[model samples]
Target: MKAVKWFAPHDMRLVEVPKPAPKPHEALIRIESTGVCGSDMHYYTDGRIGKTIITEPLILGHEYAGIVESVGADANPALVGKRVAVEPGIPCLKCEHCLRGRYNVCTTLQFPGGPPYDGALAEYSAVHAAFCFPVPDAITAAEAAMIEPLAVALHTIELAHLMPGETVAILGLGPIGLLTAQVARLAGAGRILGTDLLGYRVDVAKRYGVDAAYNAQTIDSVETILRETNGRGVDLAIDCARSTLTPAIACRVARPAGRCILTGISGEEYGQFPVDIARRKELTITWCRRFRFNFQTAIDLVASGRIDVRSLITHSFPLEQSRDAFELVSRAGENVLKTSVDQ
Candidate 1:
């Protein structure tokens, strides 16, 4: 099998390794496509995100889709030949969190494409069969690979406890942020406002159902959103920028008692926000980790055409050109939203 492995900062190589076989409850998949995620870029560019450092050669991809080439003895034989979107994180079902259906936060969770677990940036991957969600023929391989991020967005919306006709402000127009805005819109958010430092991203957000998109570099995003909301701010604010400033801005732009959700992965170990403003507003702040039990919903949303993720896939590269894919996403150039590696 051929895989892309990270050795050091800005260093990734295509190497040959033994193909893996499925365990008793697993399936061996021939990887068809893999999305280059923000976390992949963080590892490729900075060699780390907080304390999760690349201390060893690690394959760097997680959001992926593939065909079930074979199944283990105990795995479902019917899954063979099916195209599936893989949920990359495997949680320890024995943990309290997992027992309560909150497996995304399981203390002993095993996530691929990080330090220890190799990811699906290769021709093949063997994953637990239960985590592989089958998609209808209507979903393309690229779209299937996107279900992971869509799941994250869905989880964030769920955490927000969004309601019909409530206003929402999404602070960031990256792939996740744009998807979050779309999900919020479909959830019946009255008005969806999106912001990003880049104008192109703002423009992209507008096309994806945001009522208004603002470039924070050009104007005060919090103030603008408040002004449009009659100085009361939005009913819900979600920060997907992972920047130190956006969470605080989310706190500022949320109405009194409004809910705020943080879904971005911060580079810094500790983030400081405007606690005073948050306290005064009596805000209900929540943090979102990777999705839990949302992959099926995400697939259904995309498969049913309720959410359009195809447009967000601005670039695609072959598995052999994985390095270029990482570079394109890392530089955030060419108005790229999501970059995927086709196998």
Candidate 2:
């Protein structure tokens, strides 16, 4: 099997490795496509995100899809030959969180692409069969891979608890932020405002459900959003920016008692926000772990054309160019939104 392995910062190589056989409850998938995510960038550049450090060569791609080549003895044989999107995280079903159906936060969760777990950035991956979701033939493999991030956006909205006609402000125009905007629009959010450090993303935000967006680097994002609401802040504010500062900005830009959801992975263990401001406003600050109970919804949205995942897939590369794919996504230059490494 051929795999892209990350040795150190900015160092990646396609190397040959032994193919993994499926465990009793696992399935061997012939990976078709994998998407580079923001969290992967952190590992590519610094070999770490907070305490989850990559001390050894690791394969970094969690957003992925493929066809089930075969299943283990205990695995479902129906999945064989089926194209599916596999959720990269495997939680211990015996854990309290998992028992409560909040498995995304299972303390002993095993997530691929994170440290100590080889991801689906190769020609083959053996994953737990239960996490795999079969998709309709209408969507491509790349779109199936996109279901991971779409699920994340869905989780963000679930945390936001958005109400119809409520205002929203997304503190970044990246893929997750853009997807969140789309979901918010579907939830009937009014006057969706977005801000991004990059001008290209801000320019494209309107196409993805943002009513108005601007370059935060060129102006005060909080001020503009506050003014946009006539001195009141948005009803729900989401932070999807790379900077940890965006969380504080989300709090500042949210109306009193409004909700602020932090979905951004800033690579920092500790983040600071205006505690006084958050306290005074009585804001509800929630941190999103990842997606839970949303993969089917995401797949349905994309399949129904309600959410266009194709628009964000601005770049694609072959398996041999995995390094190039990471580089392009890291730089995010030339209007790059999402990069998919296809087999």
Candidate 3:
């Protein structure tokens, strides 16, 4: 088996390794495609996010799809040959959070390509059967690989409690932001606006049917949004860029009583905010965690044609070119939306 391993900052190697064996409740899958995520790029460039440092060599991919090659003795034989999109995180079922259906907050969660567990960056991966949802025949492996990110988007929108006919302003146009825009539209948001520094990303959002797109770096986002919304501001603002300036701007661009959902990954020791301004406007703010049981919903959305993630894949590299794939995603420019590694 071949895998992409991260040993240190900006250091990754594609090396041969032994294939994994599935446990009694798990399935051994022959991975077909894996997507390089923003978190993976963070680990590749900085060796860590916050205090979670990469002290040991680790496989670095989580967004993936595969075919079941073998199942545990206790597992159903019918699972064999089934194509699946892996959920990537396995929380301890014994935890209260897990029992309460909030497993995304489980204290002892094992998340692939995260702090400790290896991810699905190899030819084969052993995942819990329950965490691997069967990909419908209509969904291609490339689209299946995007289900992970789509789940993140779905979870964020759910957290926001978005309502029909609401307007939203997204402060990023990466995969997460682009997917969130589509999900918001599906949730019946009246007007979906997306912003990014890259022209290509804005173009991508436009292709996805966004009502408006902006270049945050070239234009004044808050001013433009206010004008577009007739000075009432948007009903919701989602900061998916993890940019320090984004959250503050979100507060400014949001309506007086609107909600702001911060879905980006930020490890800042302290987030400086315009407390007085937010308090004056009485804005509601929420932070998004990974996801809770949204994988199946994400797959169904794509399978039913409500979400089109197939266009999100802008680059693909075979297992032998895994290094190149990682680099392309790590240095994603205007042209790259998502990059995948294929087996």
The candidate maximizing lDDT is 2
Clashing pairs in 3: none
Return the lDDT, model 2, position 188: 87
Q: For every model in order, what is the number of clashing pairs?
A: 0, 0, 0
User: Which ranges of candidate 2 are over 4 A from the true structure?
Assistant: none
Compared with the true structure, all predictions reach lDDT values of 0.91, 0.93, 0.87
Better of 1 and 2 by TM-score: 2
RMSD values, in order shown: 0.9, 0.7, 1.4
**C-alpha-based local distance difference test score of model 2:** 0.93
Per-residue lDDT of 238 in model 1: 95
Clashing pairs in 1: none
Q: How well is each residue in 1-343 modelled by candidate 2, as lDDT tens digits?
A: 9999999998999999999999999999999999999989999999999999998899889999999999999999999999999898999999888999999999899999998999988999999999999999999999999999999999999988888999999998889999999999998898899999999999999999999998988999988999999989999999998887999999999999999999999999988889999999999999999989899999899989999899899989998899999998788877999899999
Off by over 4 Å in 3: 267-269
The residue-level lDDT of candidate 2 at 73 comes to 98
Consecutive 10-residue window with the lowest summed lDDT within model 2 = 326-335
Whose TM-score is greatest here?
2
